[model samples]
Target: MNITLKFLLLAIFSGVVHLDTMVFGQFMFSRPIVVGPIVGYFFNSPQTGLMIGVILELMYISVIPIGIKIPPDATAATILSVVFANIRECNDLGMPMSIFFGIIFSLVYKFTDIQIRTLNNMYLSWVDTAKAEFVEKRINLLVYYGIVVSFLRTILFYLIVLPIIYFIVKNVCVLIQYCPVKENFRDIIYILPAIGVGIGIAHFMEE
Candidate 1:
């Protein structure tokens, strides 16, 4: 698939996943384990997706969005990790690094999530205003408008962030690939998933 098309499709998927957080049924499709392999399959790298998904899934398995606590965006992380791994043709040496970058992106996406929530609050305010000026029939229209805006918030985020991430990861992968100590780096990669599993187990024990 063309890179542009890949990005467009992934962006749409990401948007849908984001929207699924609230507006749609809370399907687990937004989970990293689910979204990762799907994005990986699109790039003909299911193993890469599965690997990243497992690591991320384990790492985040304890998170629960209770009250006002918004967890980091794992779906974004998984999509970006799979996309970056495909772009870099990453093997074991690159996979861990790609996942690390994905974690970072997930943190960044937390801020985006906050912004999206704020936007949704604005939508609620608009709905309140409309409720005052309009009849009961128009209430549904306002609710639908909020949903559309919520969906678009994610689409816009992906469209803007994807290209920037692609360029940065592409260059970083090139630098890391040529680095003389990369052979040693794969040793670190080998341990990362194990560490994620350990953390997951610990979290489960605590819960």
Candidate 2:
């Protein structure tokens, strides 16, 4: 893939998915179930993407973005998992580790996510304080502001995180290169769905 196109795809996916949640519509498009397949399609590994997405979807089933609660970001994780796992060099080494890294990335992103919302409160305050005649104009400005900031933030994060994570995955892939375990790692992918199901069930039961 051309380097430019690769980065462009990442930018496009992250921005739209992040905005889908942050800007307005609470549509579930940001979820792994949807993101995984689309990611796979783009990476030329539709089956792998679908599997990873479904497993992650099941894993994420228990985490809800209810009022005052911001769940770990799943969009970036799903995209990274599918894309990294499909890498020709990483082979089976990419499957589990990339997904694991992706999940960790999601958790870390939650902190930034909270900060983004906190920053957006600046906009909310503007809306609250504007004079009555200018309130609608302020609200419109804030809406666009929120969307632009959120999109840029997500893109900035990808630019910073992608190379680091890719380097880690690629290096680890080398370490696992000679291991007989490498060939068997694909089975871990098959096993993950069962684990996700268990996690979902246990989460609700413990609740």
Candidate 3:
């Protein structure tokens, strides 16, 4: 595919996916029921998306965003997975590989949360200005700042990350794929998610 076309599609897909994530947060786009099949369909690989989504869905079933749980954001994970797969030219089943990269991408977002809180605080500092603007019907400035900052954050992630995931998955994962115990490794990959759910359930039962 042409680089322009690929990047364009990636941007559009990422934009839409991010918008959904922004709207629903972790509630919808992060789960298998929505993110996996949705992203797969966007890439014209529904089956792969469904399979990956199912695995991620089941794995994170007990993830809690509240209290001390602070689970990694699954929405970011799914978006980065699809983005990595495309960037790396991986097969449709790239979720098996890319989901791991998504986790890394999410670490950047830990600071994003802090940035957002900072923005809220910044806005609070301008409460008097906000009141004046509200009375003047000048919502454009607020909208402008919100859009610009949000877009900048997402764009920074894309520029910094897309290439890294592409390179690593292509080179490193390729090497791993050839290892003697690849299947055993795959079994271990599947097992961690199963264990996560089991723990989640066990924790739930205790409550």
Candidate 4:
């Protein structure tokens, strides 16, 4: 496959799939089918992506993003990490490396969450300003703001953060693999599923 074509397809997939809303928040990127395996498919390694997703899916299954607690953005990390691993020929530990990067990606999400909130506030203020200017057109004002905010948020995030993450995934993942904690993290790869299953059983019993 031509590198340019592969990158273009990945970029388009990344741009469209990464956006989050209340409903999409529940699934989409959070699920293996949508984010990880789908990205793996683009990488010409759907089975690898699926295997990695299964491991990651179990690992993070219990860690819900409730309230202000920012869980890792596994979706972003998985897509780029899988792509990088595939391209760089890190098949031996590709998935583990992807999960490791996922943790870092989650941390980035945490650090920048306040900024997103501020952006939301700023966008809301614009809506308020419009409402004041056109009292009779309040509905239109809000609609405009919603459209603008949604599009800008998605596009801007991709334009800025996605490229940065992609660069790091491509260049720095090898370093990440050699960390001292690598062995311990492999242990988590085993334990995470048991924890996920426990959570599932607990939820089932409660219901």
Best by lDDT, which number?
A: 2
lDDT of 1 at 82: 79
Q: List the candidates' TM-scores in order.
A: 0.87, 0.91, 0.73, 0.66
Residue 186 C-alpha lDDT in model 3: 54
Better candidate number, 1 or 4, judged by lDDT: 1
Counting only residues 3 or more apart in sequence or on different chains, how many pairs clash (N, Cα, C under 3 Å) in candidate 2?
A: 0
Model 3: per-residue Cα lDDT at residue 15: 51
> For all candidates, what are the clash counts?
0, 0, 0, 0
Q: Where in model 2 is the C-alpha error above 4 Å? A: 203-207
Could you tell me the C-alpha RMSD of candidate 1 in Å? 2.3
Off by over 4 Å in 3: 22-32, 67-71, 83-95, 129-144, 188-193
lDDT of each: 0.77, 0.81, 0.61, 0.59
Ranking by TM-score: 2, 1, 3, 4
Clash pairs detected, candidate 1? none
- Tens-digit lDDT track for model 1 on 67-158? 99988877778888878877654555567767878778778878977886676665455556665656565667767776877777777777
Instruction: Report RMSD for candidate 4.
Output: 4.7
Give the residue spans of candidate 4 off by over 4 A.
20-30, 127-207
* Residue 145, candidate 1: C-alpha displacement in angstroms: 2.3
lDDT of 2 by residue, 72-178 (tens): 87787887788678666788668788898999887777888889888876667776777899998887787788788888888888777777787888888888888
Candidate 4 residue lDDT tens string, 1-207: 876566666655654565453213445554654577788877678876776676666656665778877676666556655665574734355555656676576566545545665665654554456746565476666665655554455445544655565566555556656677665554544554576577667766873
Displacement of the residue 31 alpha carbon in candidate 1, Å: 1.0
